[model samples]
Target: MTPPELDRKSALFLDLDGTLLEIAATPEQVVVPPGLPSLLAHLHHQLEGAVAIVTGRPLAQTDELLRPFSASAAGEHGVSLRYADGTREELPAGIAVPSAWREELEAAVQRWPGVLVEPKPHGFAVHYRLAPEYGNEVWRLVRQLVPPEHPWFHLVPAREAVEIGLRSASKGHAVERLMAHAPFHGRRPIFIGDDFTDEAGMRKARELGGIGLRVAEVFGGDPANVRAWLMEGAQRLDGRSASSIPTGVTP
Candidate 1:
């Protein structure tokens, strides 16, 4: 079920970009909202340790953004998690894409004036925010490089890019695993995100009896507006936006 209709004993699953931090031209340009860590800490206390960030980012990156709060963080779309006990676990590695295919896609991206590729252990992201008009062309080429029927790899859409990754892993799997684990168990699931990649986590939360709160739009908007939108979304989930939760999006 959606938020407001969720049962009291639910968990909180949040997204990072567009949801917590404002989105940027490049992935690296995104800024973590100030004071989010403190807000997360308070929310954790309020929830009794039932909250966590479930995102598509890598685990280390997620931790860096939420360092101030130092709470549990998940990365690689839930393929990894840093628990409240300070333990780390990397979920199963995803299907390996052929190196030749990756190279071919990267080389082809160079022809696109404003697109850039983001490399991941099991996936790649083609970003086109700098030139939105090139998106369709970039997508067409990327799709050609990785066919839809490919068994091990698939193309997943994000806000400003398309991601190619192992089909076996996803944010949904992470939510399932986290829900079955300690501190996060028995609580209702609540997920927040702002991209198409986050849809899996949102669906998982709904299936598990929780809610997904999608962050406001962030692309091509004023920085101040983006920040305000992010803060507003956070406030809905935690009752306060900036200083209410240990922040980061991962897994």
Candidate 2:
């Protein structure tokens, strides 16, 4: 679908991995471009603080990377949230992966060699991005651990990874929660993401009278393009045409 023209009333919900940032072999290996922080901050300012990041990574990790911005965000697939005010919330009852499950996954990694076991506050993810050959094994093992129709947890599939997160927690719920708060409420939502897990958020955006843009169709699956698109929106909102982008956006 064609992307809508961004406007003053638009509230933005963005996904980090594979959308704003290039997909990396491992989560830790992902590098934040030098100008991303400032660009996001400027966009946040332009939107009157209506911009929020909805990512699978934990809020602490998001903060560590974005530093001073500390924009409102949903983390751990929406199990955790940090509002625009710096207050945080964990929607689940401190739910964590079972010891047996972690041990089993860790053991499987030894056999898989390049597969990595990622631990989260709410659950865990098995990433086979580094070892694409083990993708089937990783997916099979995750399904075996938390099968479909499991009452408490569900599988969230990303590029080459699968996470076992609470079924009750989702990007859709996260978007709703964030939109209900100040600066975001009473505005149109524009959600952009690039994975199966992001579908929920995109769907919710459409339901809420906004647009959901897929990275592949809209920007040719390039993070640089996403950033440039956002900058264009900000410039347009700032009353500057695409041809007259001035020096830079201040953080």
Candidate 3:
């Protein structure tokens, strides 16, 4: 696939799992290439600190995965945030899911040996990738625990998992919040993501006069390809990499 253009005038928002990192069997098994952090850092610097990470993972877990490098980030699908200035948006209390829900999720998954309960700071997820036969049951149970009409919670469906998080937290809102700040306010936004949760952010990017790219449709469903395209774009932006920029093209 042809790499998307990125220049200093672009404000880039990226999704983590399934976009930057391959989705592992378990969340803890995902791997980050040795050069990914540096690649992201270079892009961040080239774009004048306009890059941001928006994901469903918690802020602390994001930090742990991308350690030794930092950028503006939205976590738990925007339930938490860390802006370019190093300050974070304080979350209001009583928004977290009930502890009973977590226990129920954990106990319910026991019926299917391979299904699992993944705990998060503000919420939790039920994964049944290994136990595909139990997918429907897992979904039904989770949906029953956190109903679709719930005032404060939402059930976010993913590749082989479903997440229970705050209804108010969404990637679309995260993009809007990030775009309101310096370095990103006037720049063209390019959001790239891989799942249903990312659709909101993608739509927001397009709505605000920017580009939204889907990994499956645009990059053939491979995070490695996304990384390669990003590297090429960063090189084009920085004018210091091995990538040869088109003589008359504006990137």
Q: Please write out the lDDT profile of model 2 over residues 71-190, one tens digit for every residue.
A: 889998899988889888888776677889989999989999889988988888889888999999888888898978888888888888888889999999999888888888889999
TM-score preference between candidates 1 and 2, better one: 2
Task: Give Cα distance to truth, residue 13, candidate 1, Å.
Answer: 0.7
Give the local distance difference test score of model 3: 0.85
Candidate 3's TM-score: 0.93
RMSD of 2: 2.0
Tens-place lDDT per residue, model 1, 139-225, is 888788789798777888988788887676778887887788878887778777777878888888888877666554322423344
Give the TM-score of each candidate. Answer: 0.79, 0.94, 0.93
Ranking by lDDT: 2, 3, 1
* TM-score quality measure for candidate 2: 0.94
The C-alpha RMSD of each candidate to the native structure, in angstroms, is 5.1, 2.0, 4.1
Highest TM-score against the true fold, candidate = 2
Candidate-wise lDDT, in order? 0.70, 0.86, 0.85
What tens digits encode model 3's per-residue C-alpha lDDT throughout 70-142? 9999988888888999989834445778999888877877768999888888888888888899998988888
* Candidates sorted by TM-score, best first: 2, 3, 1
Clashes of each: 23, 0, 0
Model 1 ranges with Cα > 4 A deviation: 1-8, 216-251
lDDT of 1 at 93: 52
